[model samples]
Target chain A: MIGFETLLRWLDLAGIAVFAASGALVASRKQLDLVGFMLIAAVTGFGGGTVRDLLMGRTPVFWLRDPALLAVASAVGVLVFFTAHRIENRFRALLWADAVGLALYAVLGAEIALVGGVAPWAAVLLGVATATFGGVLRDVVCNEIPLLLRKEVYALAALAGAAAFVLLRMHGIWRDTALLAGMALCLAIRAAAIARGWSLPAYAARRD
Target chain B: MIGFETLLRWLDLAGIAVFAASGALVASRKQLDLVGFMLIAAVTGFGGGTVRDLLMGRTPVFWLRDPALLAVASAVGVLVFFTAHRIENRFRALLWADAVGLALYAVLGAEIALVGGVAPWAAVLLGVATATFGGVLRDVVCNEIPLLLRKEVYALAALAGAAAFVLLRMHGIWRDTALLAGMALCLAIRAAAIARGWSLPAYAARRD
Candidate 1:
């Protein structure tokens, strides 16, 4: 059986790859230059975790300390840049990849915060940070409103997952089992919401 | 004599105003809607410190618990949107306002980090966060390379100011004197850099 730390590391890697692919696809859609594409990929892959770590006062952010993540992201960026045209449906790919990244990050972030001794509420906030900040940075660079704030279930799903993890822990559940369960729950909810166009009600009055 | 806490409060307020103005100007240039403009202003004014506080394990980020800062930033956004044309030469105004904001934030961030029991090096990093993250976010939203990563001595100036404060404290300087000196130094260096077009060496090299 894989150690919990190793599993978390793998999930982080997968999250990075998924985010890089999504960002590179967006850059390709915009016909951005190679440098721009690389920048977007880097930001999308590492921005959220970096922000969370910085907030948590974790020194030497993961990517800065580990060159492997950057190498992998760069390689993925190059591959995506060249093969972007082969993808038949960019929007669908982006949405699916982004959802995967969001779920993975949400779990990783909450787990880290729990280990770091943060309160359950703060851990949930960190989970949201991990899931949403990268996409926020990507949208900012793409010059658009962050999709996280667009009446979507993106951040809300992450928060729910984090809450589930916290509740399971409080109930003395096994750590690894709780994490996996919470992550699976978040991914299923997010995917279903996206497929059905489910969203929370906006604060404004609804005409219908 | 003004109390130390009172001085810090005033500097924090000034930093918010300057940061909001810079963000509002950028939003105006980008032709963002009122919500977009307010969002930019709020992020620019509080994003860095919020990140810093979260990292330091401080609960309830400064602006989140205090609505006044958000209100002020929104007001500034509205004012800038209406007066954008009148404030024609935005470049000059942005430079000066950004410099003031950077200096004030550097001092405030360092002070907050110290109060939170962070190390000197970490305090300096917080200072840079307070001074530079807003501009970085603004540039990202404007779809440009971050000014800190491009032309300008922005982040470097913040670092220098932070180091000065740390050194003064090490040498037993009064806290107020150290803060004022550091802030003044940052303001002078940043303002002069902008006025004279001084910049750090670009990463590119001359092709032989």
Candidate 2:
């Protein structure tokens, strides 16, 4: 049987692939050059975790330490560039992949922050950071408003998942179980919101 | 004589003004709406330190706790929008104002990190965070490559100043003297770099 550490590593790799694929998909839609595609992929794959780790004073960021992550992201970018037209229902695929990536990142972020000795509230914030920052960076690079800031349930879903994770952990749930439960909760919430076209009310006041 | 705490608060406020102005200038260049302008100004003014504090597990982000910072940044945005056409030699003015903001932020970041019991290297990293993140965020919002990533002496100048500040503090230098000396060094370096058109080498390979 594989060790828990090995399973976590695999999840990390899967998360990177999903994020890179989403970024490349976006870039392809924009008709960006190969360099631009790769740039977006890399940023979307690593930007959030990099920011979170830097803030936490973690050194030699994860991708820097594990060069394979870069190689995988780059390969995925290339693949997407050539196969862009082959993917059916691009929007649906992108949304699903993004949801998976968000869930993985949120759980990983919460775990890392908890191990880093951060307070529970801070851990939740870090989880949101992991789930949302990659998309924010991708949107910024593509010159659009971040999806998180839109009248959507994106970040709110992540926050709910994180809070659930913390509460479960407090009640003596096993770590892996808590993480999986949190990720599932986030994925479910995100999927439902997308399916129902659910959205939060815009913060701006309505004009007369 | 002004009290030390009062002086620090004033410096922080001044830094906010300069950073917000720079952000507003970028927004004007992009022809963004008033809401966009305010968003850029607020992010540029407080994004770096907010990330830093969040990572350090500090509560109630700086601007959240002190609403005046938001007021100052908003005022600067409005002022820039109204007077943008009348402003002359904008590039030069922006360069100088940016340098002042960078120096002030670097000093403040280093001080805050030191108080938080971080290592010197981490403190220096936070200094760079304070000085450069606003510009990075602004560029991202404006859909441009961040000035910091373009390999200017920008981050280098901040790092140098941070090192100087930490060194002086280690030798028991008075806080005021150390702060002044460090800020002066960063401002001078950034100004010189701009005047000389200095930049880091591009990532692209050179053709023979």
Candidate 3:
């Protein structure tokens, strides 16, 4: 049987790999060079966790502890850089890949905070941050309007997952069970949102 | 003798306040709500330090322990929200205010890293990150091109200051003297860059 720690680490790695690929895909579309691909992929892979770690006071950062995470990201960046032209529907592929990362990261981020002794509310916020902030960084670097600034179900989906984690833990559910449930809930919502073109209300300011 | 720690704290606070104001001004330009103003200001005020501390392994985050930083940012947000229209030459004022924050934060961030046992080279990078990242965050949230991403000498100025800090410290220069010199170097460089319209070359990618 795989230890829970090993399982979690694998889950985290998978999330990072997918997110890095998504970021690199965006970089490819922008005609960024290898440096841009590498940088964007690393940032998109680690951005959310970096913000969460900073806020949660987890120092030296997760990526710093594990060099392999960055290696995976760079490898993914290289792969995408060479193969992007062969891939059709890059936009749809990016969305689906991002959704996978979003779901996993939302749950993993909250677990990190809870393990670090943060309060439940703060944990939930960290989770949402972890799931969303990376994409925010990617979009900003690519000069795209950030997803957070748009009226989207993106952040809300992460929030729902985070809240579910907290609620489940409060109800004395097993952490493993709670984790999977949270991930599933987020994934389902996000998948549905994509399938249905769901969105939150956009804020329209008065010209005057 | 005046303690270096106390002086740096005050310098950091001054930088935070100014950066917060700059961020709020952007929010006002966008006609954001109070919440938007507060968030942007706070992010601008503390974003650099937060990143620095996380990298340096300083936990609990500085502003979390001391509420004054957030309070200062929020106050600045309110002030800007009401007075933005009254201010003449906001674009010019923003450039100057940002210059002040950049100089102070450059030195302060380097100092934090040095005190936290960071290597000098890494400390210099941290310093540049600390000085420039708040503005980067502010621009991203404001939907503008980040100054760092542009062909500007902004980050170069911070890099100069951080290098000065490390050099001075290495030479056994008095902490206060070193700090002042570093800030001066950064400010002068940035001021000259602005006045002369000096810029770095933008990267052009090859399609092949």
TM-scores, all candidates, are 0.59, 0.61, 0.62
lDDT (Cα, 0-100) at B204 in candidate 3: 91
Error of 3 at B132 (Å): 8.8
Worst 10 residues of 1 chain A by lDDT: A199-208
Per-residue lDDT of B1-208 in model 2, one digit per residue for the tens? 3687798889899899888888877776666555456657877998788767876766545664566887899898878767665543466877787788899899878888888999888888888888888888788766788878886699999998888898898899987898889999998999899889888777887799
lDDT of 3 at B145: 74
Q: Clash pairs of candidate 3?
A: none
Between candidates 1 and 3, name the one with more favorable TM-score: 3
Q: List per-prediction Cα lDDT, in the order shown.
A: 0.78, 0.80, 0.82
- Tens-place lDDT per residue, model 1, B1-208, is 4688787777677778878888876766655655556667877887788868877778546654566676788788777666666654656877787788888888778878987898989999998887888878777766767867885588888988888987798789998899899999999999888888898777777798
- Any idea what lDDT model 2 has? 0.80
Give one digit per residue, the lDDT tens place, for model 3 in A23-91: 888898899999899999999999999988877777778999989999999998898889988754567
**DockQ rank order:** 3, 2, 1
Which residue runs does candidate 3 get wrong by more than 4 Å? A1-10, A55-57, A88-90, A143-145, B1-42, B48-57, B63-136, B140-208
lDDT per residue for candidate 1 within A1-208, as digits (tens), equals 5677887888778889888888888888789988888889889899888877776667678789998899878877888888888863567866877777788788778888778766676677678788778878888778776655454477678878888887898799998888888888888889999899987543221122
The C-alpha stretches of model 1 lying farther than 4 A from their native spots are A3-10, A88-90, A201-208, B1-45, B48-208
